[model samples]
Every structure is written in C-alpha cells, then in structure tokens.
Target: MIDLNQSDKRQLLFDAARELFLEQGFKKTNVAAITERANVAVGTFYKYFASKEQIFYEVYQAENEKAKRKIVARIDADQSPKEVVKQFLQEIIRTSEQNAILAEWYRNTEASQVLMNYNQECDVQKNSFVYRFLLDNIERWRSSGQFRRDIDANTILALFNVLVLLDNHKEEIGHEHFPQVLELLAEMIIDGLTASS
Candidate 1:
C-alpha cells in the first residue's frame, strides 16, 4: 500500500527541511516553510508527515547514522588504539563542523529529547560501528602488550566518550590551552595504563 513515489517525495521534504532547519534553526522553522522549501504543497507535506517535528526526527536520525558511518570508515585497523582514537576524535569534530545539518541539529535542535526516545537497541549496529571499532582496538592493544593490562576496556570506552565530547568544545577550550589539556589528559591516561614504561 506504500507508494514509492510518495516515499521519495517525503524524503525530499526531509532533505529540504534539514537544510532550512540548519539555516533558520528549529524553533523558527515551521511546516509551511518546510513545504515551501521542499517545493511541495502543504497538503503534500501533511500526507507524509503531520508536523515538522517528525521530519526533523527523520533528518536527525539519518544525519547521525551517516556521520557515524563516515567516522568509522576513517579509522585504520593498522593503527594503534591511541592513534585510532585520535583519528576518530578528529574525524568526528571535522565532519560535524563541515556538515551544517549535523552541526545545527546538535546545537539548535531538541537532540536530547530525540535521543531519549531513540531506541538504542534498534540503532546499535548503525551507532556502534565506531564504538565497537574503538573498543576492539583498545582490547587488541592491551592484549598485544602495547598498552597496559590494567586499563579495562570499559575505562577506555569512557575516556574515549569524554574525549569526543570535549573535542566538540575545542573552540571554547581555546587553541593555546586545548593542546596542553589534551597532552596532560593523554599522558595521565597512558601512564596509568602502561606497565613499567
């Protein structure tokens, strides 16, 4: 009963709405604006989604999934865990800034509310690609005697998450202080994990 053409039209709306949302911000965006931006009729918009919130959710979900995939693809298996983590952190920060939709979604949208309702189990594979890569590499490095055995995988995961969150505020961290903070943080973590080194 689902019409392919209708589905495509809906996606078109989502795409246009995302761009507009990034430019105008969510609180300022509305259903009429989305339809006009999509070059579709208001009735056409209602046929696909009842409101802008639903379209926003779709757009956010798609962007988040794409960003996660791109970040994971940037990781190299040959790299050490520390290097891999650094690459991931850099990629995420760079990609998020470059992708206007993603930047706006995180900065201006109700991301916390959407994330609360998002099904982690359903999104596990799409969302965890980078996480699994990071965790697996951490374990590999530890087993290979490259990193200290005392550093548990869970601890590494926590640190990686914290680093990624911190990287998002790099501008606030300031160019002069960011490197010093990162170096100090990395040294403390590595020293705690390293064996006799």
Candidate 2:
C-alpha cells in the first residue's frame, strides 16, 4: 500500500505520468500505465485527472513553471543584454539535453499534437511565463538602449520561439553540433537586436 498523503499521491501520479508521457508520448501513454507506474489503483487516476490528456496538460504546465523559475532565478541586471540572451539560450539547451525524455517528446508528433490541443484549450499566450519574461526583457533592453528599439517584443519573441524549436532538433542536427548551432543562433539574435548607430 502506498501510504502517502493526498498531495504526495497527487505529486507521485503527476511525476509518473509526466515521465511516461515524455517517454511514450500522449497517444501511447494510458491511465493504467500511469497508475501502475505511480503504484496506485487504476481507478485512482480518475480521482486526480479526468483523462490522460488532463494529466499531460497539468504536467506540461508544471514543467513550464519549473523552467520559468530557473530562468528567472538566473536573471541578473548586471549582465549585458547579449550575455543574458546567451544565458537564456544555453539554459534552455542544457535543460533539454539533460532530460532525454523531454527531448523525445519534442521530437514526437503525438506529443506535439497533445501540446497543440492543450495550448488551444488553455490561455497559453496570456499565461506563458516564458513569453511574458521575454517581453519584459525586450522592453527593458529597448528602454536601456541595449536592444534595437525598432522591433517589438512580440516579433523578437517569435524569433526566439523559432530558435527554441530548432534547438529541439538535436538528433537531426547532430548532438555535437547542437551547442555550436545554439551559439550561432544567439549571435544572430544579438546582432539583430543590437542598436544601430
């Protein structure tokens, strides 16, 4: 018997489901598998989540929150704009490489579909801490004359999103080259955002 408190059981299920979803993706992962991995009864899954999709979305949100905390904690006003951008990109790449399960999910079509559905069902734009953080950083840089004032935060953020997607393609790009590619990407972003004379 899993003698855990309500919160502990919920966290156990969440962690198990997240790992399974990342490893096998949303389409292949089922409630039974999740419960079994969590050491809980199959029926107990319904007590926490309506479906596998629900648990996946919650897991996604939790992961995003964790990433946000890490990013925010690393921020420093003393750092140069380019340095900050490099740090952000490096952190993202490092996190993805360290978590093979997440990397697998990013390369899986079913996981992408699940993420799309979850984004559509949730207030993704408004609730995304990453987007909000990028927007704020862009505004700060522009005000401080560290970044080009011509490009709006939304456009810069869109470019950043593209870079993030590219980062997810490490297998195709070759693991050894991925870090160099990210460095080049960071340089390009910095060049584009640099204030013109």
Candidate 3:
C-alpha cells in the first residue's frame, strides 16, 4: 500500500496530472493514467479530485501561482519604471518558457476553455495577483512622475497583459527573435509611458 497523507497524495496526483497534461494534453490525459503515474489506485484519484478536469484546473492554478511568486520575488523598488517593466516582461516570458505545463496549457484551446470556465466561476481575473500588481505599479509610476499622468493605470496594465499573452506564441514568433521583439515592445511601452518634460 502507498502510505501518504492527504496533502502528499493531493500533491502527487497534481504532479502526475500536470506531467500527463503537458505530455498528452488535457483531452488525451485520463484519470486512470494519472493514477498510474501517481502510483495510486484508480479509485484513490477520486478522494483528491472530482475529475481529470478538476485536477488539471488545480495544476494550472498552482503553476500560475508559482510564476507569480517568481515575478514578485524579483521586483525591486529601486529599479526605474522602464527597468521594472522590462524585467517583468522578461520574467513572464522566461517563466512561460521554462514551465512546460504552462506553455502547453496556453497552446491548447481545450485547456484554455476549461481554464476560462474555472476563472469565471472563481472570479480569478479580477482577484488575480498579477492584475493587482500591474495596476499598483502603474499607479505608483504615474504618482511618482515617472509615467504619463494622462493615461489610465488600467490601460497601461492592459498593455502589459497583452505582452504576456504574446508570450504564448514566442516559439512561432521565432525563439531566436522573440527576445528582441520583447525588448522592442518594452522600449516602446516605456517611451509611451514616460512623462513629458
């Protein structure tokens, strides 16, 4: 018998499901496969998740939190607004590329639909840390005379969100040239946001 606590079992299931989803996608990954990968009996999966979709949703949320924590950890108050925006973009792109599950999730329409439904039910978009962080940073830059006062903070934050969305297509955008594209985009945003003398 595989002896494990509730948290351990849940974590094991999540890890196994995430790998399967990344490798085979949400539609192709099944509960039995997840349990097999987790080294748990098929019935044991029910104790942790209601369905494969539920496990995939949890995995997506966990990965999103991990990426957010990484970006938050790198934030520095001493950095200039331009530097901060550039760094944030760089971190988002790096995190998306490094996390195979996240990259795969973005690539799959089925996964995205499930995530969208989950987000709607949870009101996650409004309460997201990334959304709040961008809003707060935009407000701070404007108040500090670093960014243009004419533009709304939400609008600036929306642009940032757009850049993050673009990261999903970085591979098709030419991995060799994606970094340059991001840099150029960052420069344009910084220039547009900068306060006039």
Please provide TM-scores, in order, for all candidate models, with all chains considered together.
0.66, 0.71, 0.72
Give the per-residue lDDT of model 3 (tens digit) for 40-131: 98888998888887888889888888788779788885689888777877777678777766765546667766776676689675867877
Local accuracy by lDDT, each model: 0.69, 0.76, 0.79
Between candidates 1 and 2, the lDDT winner: 2
Specify the poorest-scoring 10-residue window by lDDT in model 1.
112-121
Error of 2 at 124 (Å): 2.4
Error at 3, model 2, angstroms: 12
Comparing 1 with 3 on TM-score, the higher-scoring candidate is: 3
Ranking by TM-score: 3, 2, 1
Write model 2 residue lDDT over 125-146, tens digit each, in one string.
6777877777888888888998
Clashing pairs in 1: none
Give the lDDT ranking, best first. 3, 2, 1
Q: Better model by TM-score, 2 or 3?
A: 3
List, residue by residue over 91-189, the lDDT tens digit for candidate 1: 765686677666653454365345334433255534566677767877888888877767678886687566545544556787557655665676566
